[model samples]
Target: MQIAYLMNTYPVTSATFIRREIAALEAQGVSVRRFAVRPWDQQLVDDADRQEQTRTTYLLAPGGLRLVLLTMAESLRNPRGFWRAAKTAWTLYRNAGRGALVRHVAYLMEAVHLKRLANGCTHVHAHFSTNTAAVALLCARLGGPGYSFTAHGPDEFLDPGAASLGLKLQMARFAVAITEFARVQLALAGGMGIWPKLHVVRCGVDVTDLRPAPPPATDAPFVCVGRLCVQKAQEHIVAALADLHQTHPQARVILIGDGDTRPAITAAIARHGLGEHVELRGWADNAAVKDALSGARALLLPSFAEGLPIVIMEAHALGRPVISTYIAGIPELVDQQTGWLVPAGDVPALAAAMRACMDTPPEELASMGAMARARVEAAHDVTRNATDLKALFSRYV
Candidate 1:
């Protein structure tokens, strides 16, 4: 089957799962074409191009210098793609004569982005609920194959109207949400009868290849992985590290991933005198991060909001229990068996949970870790997820 994968920003350094999922599908002999918005800004263009399988295309819209604007004039304003193009034109016209209007012209570029992906694909699946899905849905409406998308996390789930849910549902044949919570909320936000079409498809991880934790010779190391942003609640993790240090001074804390809040998080570490105990290792790739998770005593993610974060699934697959917040769909994975879930923004509670993990014996922690692996294998296998996608795509066929 021919498939087109759409994302708001492809080659995003932060979200390697996009590439992982595309690789998983192509491995099954499916013809997968990749498309992205704002392509030039991405640094991994070389990585996608070097791939022997799947064809990768960049949707450079109407703004650049010459070609895109002319293409927009022909294809975007074309009858099949008129409504979206008109909306784009209107947005541009509204801001006309101002230099700022030029950027809004990017919307017109969606006409070309969609048209190119629709050419031979049997299905179009976009990631997240930003304008990326808008472009995919717009193309599907203009005689493209059935289109769908996977929505994730805060920006998309927290603010529904930003993605134009009415238009999204009207154009989408199916909608996938990373968490059950996200699925229900998107249904409510869409304000359409298509609520029944929403599906909960948690992003999966490779269960077999994950490395096992070290033998019980060394003291357990606690780690947290994700961008150091507000939603990640790294600050809470820092507070927990302080508590861990006061009691179990032998416990070591390592942080992976980088973002806007690095300075503040680093400053917090200094304020708490956690320099000796805590270390920041920024932006490790999937394999490296998984290796870290494999050896860690626990994977900490005290986030303020989430949509079944892929990291949590990966951690469980690697045999590590997660210590996370109860917000959104987090409770689905973390519960009495696998890990602890505390209220969002509760630093003291998070601190206590960390101490509990540190104080727990190695044999007990290992049993919980084994449960993590079992839970992931039973529910979130990558192949199973792809199989379901094939069945879902058959509807459009």
Candidate 2:
């Protein structure tokens, strides 16, 4: 069967899990077409993602006039579909706040463009229940392929009204939640009717691609991988490191991602006199990330919110235990056995965890690392989860 995968921006540094999902499906004989609303203009560190950008069709790349002309031709060719899409757009404009009218109109135009391009596809699956899902809903209304979407938390659940997540869930043929925690949130927002359409499909990593590296022989710097954003709380990590330095002066942390919060992170490093202990490596590709994980004492992520971060799984797959906050779907993957779990925003507790990682015996840390790898093998195997996702798509198609 043929399928179209829709994304807001293709090959984003943090959302590589989506790329893995698409590759796994294609490996199993699924004919998949990749579509992005816009091209990612940021510096791409991964060669694989750079290659994927060439294969994806960007809907907004043809300029405004071309989009208007193509949309007009599509409307003239299929008047009934045009009316259906128009009615849907009108409903969204009326029900969604007045400020969203222009955005909804843009979604309608993009839907028309997608309907023209997505020929011979049996289904369309989008990654987020935000803008991409809104466009997918309109695409279905415009006589395009049946559409579904996956909802990852922190944003959609925090502000469902602004996101119009409930309406998107009702419109989709099926909906995917990355964890049971996310599924429950979708049910709460969309009501009991959404339960039937919701499925739990985790964002996973390929274990075969990850070779287990020996644990660090001595105390090594901890590594954190994710966007340098407020939600990730990298600043908190910097603060906690200051407290940790009083006891374990040798403790160091290397943050391996980039975002708007870099200035604040840099300030924290300078403010706390952690310049020597903290290092910002900007963005690294999957290969570089693996190399970073292989030599680390542990992986640290003091996030205030998450949808079960793929970096946690990647760290586990490489036999590196994780130290993350107990928020969102994080508890489902991390525990005392796997690593340390601290409450979010508690600097004292975060510092204590960092100190524990430094003080723990090498043999005990290695044992925990082994358990971490075993857990990932059992729950986050990309090949197995991709088969389950394909089966779900088959049932709908």
Candidate 3:
């Protein structure tokens, strides 16, 4: 069966899980038409993502005039559908905060274009219950394909009204959550009546592609893989390192992602005299990330909010334990056995976990890494999870 996959942006550096999921679906004989609101203008680290860029059609690529023309054409072709979709967009705009009118209008135009593009697809599925979902919802109202979306939090949970989460869920044929925690949040946002529409389909990593590597020495530097953002709380990692450095000066940490928080993290590293102990490696491709994880003692991500990071699974697949927080779906996968679990924003607790990683014996660490690998193989195999998604799509189609 043919399907349309929509997103706000495609072929990005951090969202490789989506790429993997699409690839797995294609391998199972599903034809996927990729659509995005816009293309990633930044450098993509992975060649797979680069290839995906060629396959994705950007609805906004034609700019304002083209979108206006398409909207006009769509309205003339299906005046009734256009009117219905326009009303939905108006409702969304009224529900949103100040300055959201322009955004909703753009979503309306994008939906008009998507309605033309996704004509024959059985259904459309979007990642993130944000603008992509908004556009998808509007497109369905425009008599396009029925659409569903996957909600990843805690951004979605932070402000459901701004995202129009309830309305999106109410209109969607089915909704997917990356974790059970995320599913619960979707149910809360969409109301209990829509609970039957919510399903848990985890973002997964390919275990075969990311096979376990030899465990690193206990004293090896830790690696953190994620965007350097406020939600990731990477600055807290620097603070914890500073505290850890007071006792273990030889300890080292490598941060393997990049974002707006680089300046703050860099300043903190300098302020704490941790230039030698902390290295901001910026963005690395998938191969480089796996290599970095292979050599690291463990993965560290003290995120203030998350919907289960794919990096944690990647590290676990590589037989490396994680040092993360007890937030969202993390505790479901990571605990004392997998790696260290510290309270978010607690610099002292983070420092203690860092110390624990430093002092843990190599054999014990390997044992923990083995358990981590087992957990990932059991719960996060990409092919298996994709099959579950395929089943859901089949039921709808």
Candidate 4:
């Protein structure tokens, strides 16, 4: 069967899980077309993402005039479908703020273009319950294939009404939530009656490709893999590392992603005198990330919010423990048995967890890594999740 995958931005360095999902479906003999609102504006460090860029069709890449022309042509060809899509866009504009009326109009234009681009696909699956999903919804209204979206929340749930998340959920053929917490939030927004349409589909990793490495040494540094954003709370990690420095003078952290908060985090590192202890390695390719995880004692991600970070699964797949916060779906995967789970934004608790991980025996850490790997095998295998997703799509196709 042929299907389409859509996202606001495709081939992003941090969102490798989406690529893996599409690859897995292709391996199962499905013809999957890639679509995106736009290409990632920054330089893509990963070779895989660079390759994926060539395969994606960007709605906005051809410029605004092309979108306008497509909207006009599609309206001339199918006025009824165009009106239906426009009415849906108007509802979304009303549900969201009136200030975003232009954005909603742009979504309708994008949907018109995408409908032509994805002519033969049996279904269209979008990655986030945001603008990408809005375009998908409008496309379906314009006589396109059935559409579904995976909700990875924190932003989507923050203001569901403004996001038009409830409307999207109700209109989608089926909606996927990466975690049970996310599914509950979707239910809350869409109301309890739409619960039957919501399904929990965890983001997954390639278990076989991420073979476990030898156990890390006692003096190994902690590796945190994610964007340096406010939600990721990398600043808290810097503060915690400062506190741990007195007890574990040789301790160090290697942050492996870049974002807007880099200057703030840099300032925090300097202010805390953690220039040597906290290192910002910026964005690394998948190989570098795996190497960093392989050499680390534990993965540190004291995020204030998350939708079960795939890096946690990757760290476990590489036989490394994780020291993350107990927020979102993290508590479901991490505990004392796997690694440390500290409270979000609690610098003291985070510092204590880091210290404890540093002080833990190597054998005990290895045992925790074993359990973590087992957890990934059971719940976060990319192949298995893709099969499940294909089954869901098959029902509609």
Off by over 4 Å in 3: none
List TM-scores for all candidates, in order: 0.89, 0.98, 0.98, 0.98
Error of 2 at 227 (Å): 1.0
| Model 4 spans with C-alpha error above 4 angstroms | none
| Per-residue lDDT of candidate 2, residues 1-397 (tens digit) | 9999999999898889989999999999999999999988898889999999899998888878888898888789999998998898887777677698878878888898888789999999999888899899999999999999988987878778767778888888999999999999999889998799899988889999887788785868899999999999999999999999898888889999999899999999999998888999999988999999998999999999888999999988888889999998999989999899999999999999988888888888888989999988888988888898899899998
RMSD of each: 3.5, 1.1, 1.1, 1.0
Per-residue lDDT tens digits for candidate 4, residues 1-397, read: 8999999998999999999999999999889999999999899998889999999999987799988988999999999999999999999999898689889999999999899999999899999999999999999999999899999887888999988888898889999999999999999999998998898888899999999989997679999999989999999989899999989999999999999899999999999888888888999999999999999999999999898999999999888999999888898788898999988999999999999998898899899999999999999999999988988888866
Model 4 root-mean-square deviation: 1.0
How does model 2 score by TM-score? 0.98
Estimate, for each residue in 164-258, the C-alpha lDDT of model 3 and write its tens digit.
Answer: 89999999999999999999999888899999879998889999998888869646898999999998999999899888888888889999989
Error of 3 at 371 (Å): 1.0
- The lDDT values for all models are 0.72, 0.90, 0.92, 0.92
Instruction: State the lDDT at 90 in candidate 1.
Output: 55
lDDT of 1 by residue, 1-397 (tens): 8888877666665676677677777777777788777553533323443352134566664346554755446564566555645564554345333564454456455645566546877888888876677667556544556688888867776555544665576668888887788887787887648777888777777666664565333576778888789989897788887876788788887899888899999999999988887889986666677678877888889988777777888888776878998888888778858888889988889888888887777787778878888878877777777767667777755
How high a TM-score does candidate 4 get? Answer: 0.98
